[model samples]
Every structure is written in structure tokens, then in C-alpha cells.
Target: MPVDAPMPGSYGVRIPPWLAAEQATLPARITDRTERMRMVNRIAARNVEEGTGGPFAALVLDSDTGDVVSAGVNLVLSANVASAHAEVVALSLAQTRVGDWNLGTDPARPRALVGNAQPCVMCLGTLIWSGVKALDFSVPGFEVERITGFDEGPVPADWREQLEKRGIAVDTGLLQEECSTVLEDFRSRVAAGTITLYNGG
Candidate 1:
């Protein structure tokens, strides 16, 4: 390899046109936690049908007002990027929208990240660094691995404490049955050779 081999300078993932249109139809604010989780679950299920990526979707929301800041689905397969998980995409979009990398900068208007499933190891680090004040998820990592065969990596046993120590609130098992149903459906599709199962080392 040479220094001037005309290497690619940059790369990025864009939300699919369909997902963007769906986002446009979302209400300006969703105050109910159950409703938030329901939306994420629906998006995650649709991601599999859309053949975008794995069964996952996430959102960045104003914790206080429940205003949706950004929505993202797994684009790892479609975007050809391993790091394009739902949580990362949503967080990145939120950062870009606010023009600040640190989401917790505004103390009065804290943010929360809501996802269909628990974050993988890489996304755990992303969440820590993103400065979001809270995390809400529907399904656990074990369920994700059991149903989808996707490796979530070795998340720390004290993962909740890790986030709490940094002043990030943690909530889990929101609409677990619904979220797990989505994962189960994705597994069936994969078994039927209709969808690709992506698992990174």
C-alpha cells in the first residue's frame, strides 16, 4: 500500500428514504414511555422486512418533554458499516442536529436514548461518551442473542452501575414481549434463508 494510493477519505451512513418518511410522520412529542418503546419495536421489526440491517431501532428524545430528536435503525448491512447500529446512528444524528457532541451539555433539557434492545459493547461505550442522561430499552441482551444469534459482546455485569455512576439513568424491560416478538420474527426469517444474520467478532 502506498501513501498516495487514492484512499477513500470518508464514509457515512444515511437513513433510508422509507425510514425518513416514517420519521416525518411521528408526532412532535411522545410523552408515554410505553408509546416510545412501541415505536422502536415497530421500527425494529420493519428493519428486518426492509432488509436494511439487524432487528434494531433506537431514538434520541428530550427526556423532559419527550420530543423526538432523532430516529435510527440498524444500517450495518445496507450501509456496509459494522458500526452503524441503531443506537449509534440515532445518537450521531442527535449530536449533528444539536451541533454538539455532548448531549448532556444542556442541563435543563437532558436527553434519553430509547432502543428496542440492550446496547452491544461498542454501543455501550458510545452511550457513555455521548452524554445522554438516560437509557431505555425493551429487551435484554440475552434475549437478543438467544433469538437473533447476534453477538452483543461481553457487556459488564455491573453495566447498570457503570451508567448510573456517570449520572445516566437506566430503564429496561419496557414492552419486552413486543420487542422479543420482533426478534423472534427476524430469527424465523433468517432460518428461512430470507434474511442475513450479521454477527461481528
Candidate 2:
């Protein structure tokens, strides 16, 4: 749902091993990063259009030894509702090179469903369908289930059952107040570091 902060260098927290291995081929590059990412993005979108419903992130392999060069998450938003914004952004990045990109990961509740809800159910559902695992800090009003902890680990009973029934889980106590700022900083760090991929413009 709402992608949360996972251990920065840990590769297995949110992203699956198979996918990561697949993406490892593309070396992180700056020269044509944006354009290449966009091309891969179109492919992911096509997957969604074909009823795959993928906000799928693709890794651009080096084409020779299969080293991961870059990755990009696609299909930022589906329903056009303001509530789904964060999930879209997170998915966008996660599908890219920043493997475990956290989308806030903090426990949150929206005052109204209008333009504030984090990890909207629909958007989350789309992510789950794409086979991506996300760590949410807290999930409230959850009659179905609940999750616990900020890192990847065991979850609550209710949540386990819910996941068994429906392909999703929500954790509690993973909430943090500085999620947005941290997310911004993380992005800035990546963008700054990869300026060459964006052509150092």
C-alpha cells in the first residue's frame, strides 16, 4: 500500500529476490536515465492496460552480463483520486533502481478520504496484484487484520488471516512523524547522486 522506509541498504525487505536479480543487470547510468526509464514505463503501462493492472517497475539490464543499470516504477495513479498519490509515487520508484524505495512507511490516518488518505485500498490492491510487498507502519479501523513493527518481520494474527483471505497486510507501531521529509531527502539524495543519468543538467 503506502510504501514505508525499509533498511536503506537491505535488498530483500520490500522487493522480492527474483525481481531484484532480474534488475541487477542494468548498471546505474545517468546519461540516458530519464528517457530509458520512460521507455520501460510505457511497457509497464501496457501491461496494466492489458488487464494486468501493473504499476510494475522494470529493471533495465546491461544487455551483456545482465548487470542492473536502472529501474523505474510505472502507473503512478489509476483512479485519479487524490488519496492515491503517495502509493503511485512509491510504486514508481520501487519499480525502478531504488529497489526498496519507502513511500513514507509511517503509520497514518486520513482526516477524510478526499485528498489525504495514505495507501488507498485500491492503489494498494494494484500493488499487491503486481506481487510487490510493502511495509506499512500502521493500519487503523482494520476489522480484517493488523500488522506490527517498522521492519520486515512477523505480523499480527488478524492481519495474517486477512492476507490469507485477501492478498494484503497492515502493520502497526511502524508509524513515524517524519516520513514525508525523510522521503523527500531520500529522493533528493538519489537524484543528486545520479545526476549523470539525468545528464548532469
Best by lDDT: 1
| Per-residue alpha-carbon lDDT of candidate 1 for residues 116-199, written as tens digits (9 for 90 to 100) | 999999999999999999999989998888888899998999999999999999999989998999999989998999988887
What is each predicted model's overall lDDT from 0 to 1?
0.92, 0.32
Q: Against the true structure, what is every candidate's RMSD? A: 2.1, 18.6
* Model 1 global lDDT (CA atoms, 0 to 1): 0.92
Task: Give the worst 10-residue stretch by lDDT in candidate 2.
Answer: 109-118
Candidate 2 structure quality by residue, lDDT tens digits, 140-192: 32311221111212334354455436433433322222322232332344456
Looking at model 2, residue 123 earns an lDDT score of 49
TM-score of each: 0.96, 0.27
Q: Which ten residues in a row have the lowest lDDT in candidate 1?
A: 1-10
TM value for model 2: 0.27
